[model samples]
Target: MSQPQAAVGAAVPRVDARLRVTGRAKYAADNSPDGVVHAVIVDSSVGRGRVTGIDTRAAEGQTGVLKVISHLNAPELPPVEGGFPPGEPLRPFQDDRVRFFGQPVAVVLATTLEVAQHAASLVEVAYDAEPVSTDISVADPADEPETYARGDADGALDSAPVRLDLTYRMARNHHNPIEPAGIVARWDGDRLTVWEKTQDVQGTVATLSGEFGIPPDRVRVISPFVGGGFGSAARAWVHSVIAALAAREVKRPVKLVLTRRQLYFGVGYRPAYEYDLRLGASRQGRLTASAHDIRTENSRYERHSEGVLQPGRMLYSTPNVRQAYRHVPLDVSTPWFMRGPGYSTASYAIESAMDELAHELSLDPLKLRLRNEPADDESSGRPFSTRRLRECYLAGAREFGWHRRNPKPRSTRDGDWLIGMGMAAGVYDTERSEAHASVRLDADGTALVQSSASDMGPGTATSMTQVASDALGLTMRQVTFRLGDSLMPPAPGHHGSRTMASVGSAVQDGCDKLREQAISLAVRDEDSPLYGADAADIVVRGGRLYVKDEPTRGETYQRLLARNNRSHLEAIGSYAGASESEKFSFYAYAATFAEVAVDARLGLVRVRRMVGVYDAARIINPRLADSQAIGAMTGGIGQALLEHTVTDHRDGRIVNANLADYLVPTHADMPDMKAIYIEGEDYEADPIGVKGLGEIVIVGVAPAIANAVFNATGRRIRELPITPEALL
Candidate 1:
């Protein structure tokens, strides 16, 4: 009989889809321990101040209010060992100083969530306010910038035949996931267990252990499901610490969930950016030199930085390049990664500048990008492992019907709507980290795999199951994948799109080892049908081992294991990660196209359709890949037209903290979207040959829409969101 089809390349439905749709999957806040109590935090009103007094008498008098804890009565936490970025992480109730407007000052515990919320409001606080610097435009950047220079950018810009100078501003964005940040902490003696909504369970365990000064093994983090993270849940925020601390103090399980408004200040956000770009190119669209000066916001106490300067340095073949990235301190919470992160932000400026150059030179936007494609990574001076960007562009152009577009601005029009088409290129680094997985093949001919990696809605379990099934020569139904428990084999946090390349490789290794062990036992057994067969010549399909040349001589794994009297075969698989001395520059590439309709009179812009073609090596599951690309495109729509976190600088307050005021893309706003992936693999990049698909999908989306808007209305709106006021 012919061998069964492999499960790796098939479009399999998510393994947990049934559980998710039926409300059987337990989220972080879904768990309520036997004696769980509720805790609510009281936020500071002043932007910058010292707590003069905190009156908890009224809160203490309320019925069901167990205690109101603040700096005065709260126990001191041990010094944390290591924190994110490079500064002091916010410690809940550690001192009287209020660094930001919504800094948590006190927590109230009660028998019910309603009582805790009511009592938290009754707790009074007085502060000595100080003048705060909350504005990024007016604030001074760091005196010494992080700078990179290869050739004389200034001299080259002066001598180039064509040049363009542009400045763009982007609004700060929040990760408003459907599930708010929450934690349920229960301590028994010196050991602790927490059910948290987080992207990294092991990262949470480490943070909690460091704060409580306990061994790492003493803290257990269980997170089976995460509604959505988008980088907000990557780290253990201050709310998590507060919940654990309260549970320890009260000697009972404590559950703390941030309100929708509190999410604005409680968790991390994408920092706003002010980017000034200067480009010098030949008249024929050959890039010669570029200079980028970027300024972004961070907290006064801690500094947060990202890869905003990377794309500026190496996206195209520029001989001379200069970059200076600086952080402006503000009296606000420190920013963190959101979706595409720095690469997406930089692409907005670089890709927009390229489009502007194309308009100036009277060339097709796609052709202009093709003219400047780099042979190798200029920044690192290394050849790319697999750069299919040219293929991506060609595929996108054909699928998007680039030839039908009218190059002239304001040239295509329907009834009261000016139609325009535009496109941009995007790039993101292919990052990998060390990971491990545990695999076991039971005597009953089934397999179980476990890892500590998280699945923040990317269908990680499904993808891993596919890999394991293919490697073990078993049907998809015979393999099961489990994740999100700290006790499992170690793996990196589920961010940066590294889960598939790193964790998937580990699973493949474990399954392959276990299969080889079974083959060895079968080849050596006297009673087995393939007893004398060469192990190297043996292949397995549907749990049956047979010789490659002679298919009839085979034995079922069930019979082979029973003859050996073995209960199970197990192995620990590991991936040492990317090479320290890397030979090639690795990155994922995308070409995004957009068609938009602009109403000049009403200053409104609506996207009609979008097409994105990507070079994310070797898709494991087409269904999951399409979901990631489409979801990211939707986020791109929000970034381009709706999402913005408004702040009132006068008091450092987020003016539009709730969803009603802060806008996002509803189902009504989404238009036709299509995502296409180039087929093939890049073995040089990783063992699994996947370059990561999540972040690159959103990288160039905003610029494509912006370019389309310009084409429709002949207006160069440098700022984001393409608001009506700007168009008018």
Candidate 2:
């Protein structure tokens, strides 16, 4: 008999690929509850102000208009509980104050979307406008900045033989997913149900329950599909709350979908940053000390913070390091995590500075990095669970043809284009959180597994099915996995790249337990074949239980259950997550290499190719991993050369609110891209031996492209989106 193939390491197609291609998949906006009415928000014209008057008589008189609700007539909601970032969260239609541009001031509900939209426009709102501070450079920073220090950075910089001081400016970026944010909400008496475009369904439920002054069990959020959520959908924004409120007031289901224009301010964005870096290294390119001062934009109401200081403290072996991160309040909506979040922003500065030092020392950029590889995490003083960054560098360099590149800028020219090669290292935390999964094996020789985790375009369902198939020793076709319902066993939110490490592990545990239960029953049964055999020696494959050394002595699960008059086996698997006092530092590592061509006359920078080697431990699905890597690389290319969110400081309005004006990389802009994963396992990081992959792929991409531009032009552009004017 042929041995059954394991599904875990195989390149399996996504289980939902057919559903997506056939248009059977249902996203948040696709849900249409019975008797659903449409709602359109009337946004504020002023950036900062208080609403003095609202004339809704014209909107209320419109045909099919059910009601026009604003802060003037809206009921008071319960105070929000446990707001994030240690400040007040924006509540829609709850107050008269307009905190930022496009703040929702009124909601128009009608029988159809067109009527609601038209009515929303008819509503007139008068604001007492106030001066706005939207530019980070002109705004004052927080009174106290978050500070960290390991040694005397000032003393080291003063004594070092070589030093470089650089300042970088990064424009704000929006998520701009293919599908805009939407919600379908219904209130059945005291219980509420909602279908929302969110990365965390349970988190949305909690937020709604708190605001409505209802019990947790009274709220249910269902979101089976997400078009694409970089990080904007991780939390329940105020729009979701507004939808629910409208449903209750109108006594019918309400559907609210943000238009393309509304998405600019309706959802969160990646805030702009001004990073100032000073590094001191030896003449031979060995690091001595570094200091980083970072200021990023935030809203005056909510103080947003992230892991911006982590990379500066631990990415290298620098002994003396000082870091200060401050938030500059602006008249805008709060910013949230976008792609790699803080690590990507910091890497651009740190890695670019490293490349500059390499050039100053007349050394290979790759070699200079190799010289400062850390044995342990310098920030936490903990050994690494698996730091294969050196291997990544060596493998990436070999694959990307690093040895053939000339050191001097502008030396290699391809006719009108100046060709150059550059590389940078990337890292992100191997974050894990408590999770649970429920598994049930039926007598029909099939299994079902479930969790509350979300997919968010990483193929979570497919990967979890693969893990379950391997753990249960069943064929991939016989196992089914389901997610995105609050009723399923609890799991962590599908952000931070923790879905695989946390939810996948729980699925494996659940499947293993069910398989073991069946084995125990078969061994103890007198009527079963191989009775009294050692349970330890028993293994299940292709839904058949057999002795490991004697494959012929086996029985099908279907027959065994039939003979024993059994129905099914079930188990709930759980993982308690990482310990706070763990001894090892856990992170996913990558070495990204890029090749670019610069048109000096037009000041254009075009990427020719990119290669990324990652050490993310075990990969459940290579196909899915490659998709993540390539997509992130594309986004990075946009960040390096095109994408930017322009703000009008005059009134705190986003200048380029639509895609036509705000640029992203097109198909023509993308070039050859490759992703290679190192073969290994990191058991210390999680039970599945898998570190996170999604965020790390994008961490160092911007820096790699930026470094390549410098190599081609011999001009250091410290700002992001190395624009044509900047290159010229």
lDDT of 1 by residue, 1-728 (tens): 22334998799999999999999999999999999999999999989989999999999999999989899999999887457777899998989999998999999999999999999999999999998888999999878789999899999999999999999999999999999999999999999999999898888998999988999999999998999989999999999999999999999999999999999998889999999999999999999999999999999888888889999888899999999999999999889999989999999999999999999999998889999999999999999999999999999999999999998999999888999898999999898989999999888999899999998899999999999988888998999999999999989999998999999989988887888888899888999998878888888889888898888999888898888898889999999889999999999999999999988589788889999999999999999999999899899988988888888888899999999988988888888999999998988978878988999999999999999998998888999877888888
What are the C-alpha RMSDs, in order, of all predicted structures? Answer: 1.4, 1.4
lDDT of 2 at 379: 97
TM-score against native, each model: 0.99, 0.99
**Model 1: ten consecutive residues of lowest lDDT:** 1-10
Identify the runs in model 1 with alpha carbons over 4 angstroms from their true place. 1-5
lDDT of every model, 2 decimals? 0.92, 0.92
Could you tell me which 10 consecutive residues in candidate 2 have the lowest summed lDDT?
Answer: 1-10
Model 2 scores a TM of 0.99
**Candidate 2: regions farther than 4 A off:** 1-5
Tell me how candidate 1 scores on lDDT.
0.92
- The alpha-carbon deviation from the true structure for residue 127 of candidate 2, after best TM-score superposition, in angstroms, is 0.5
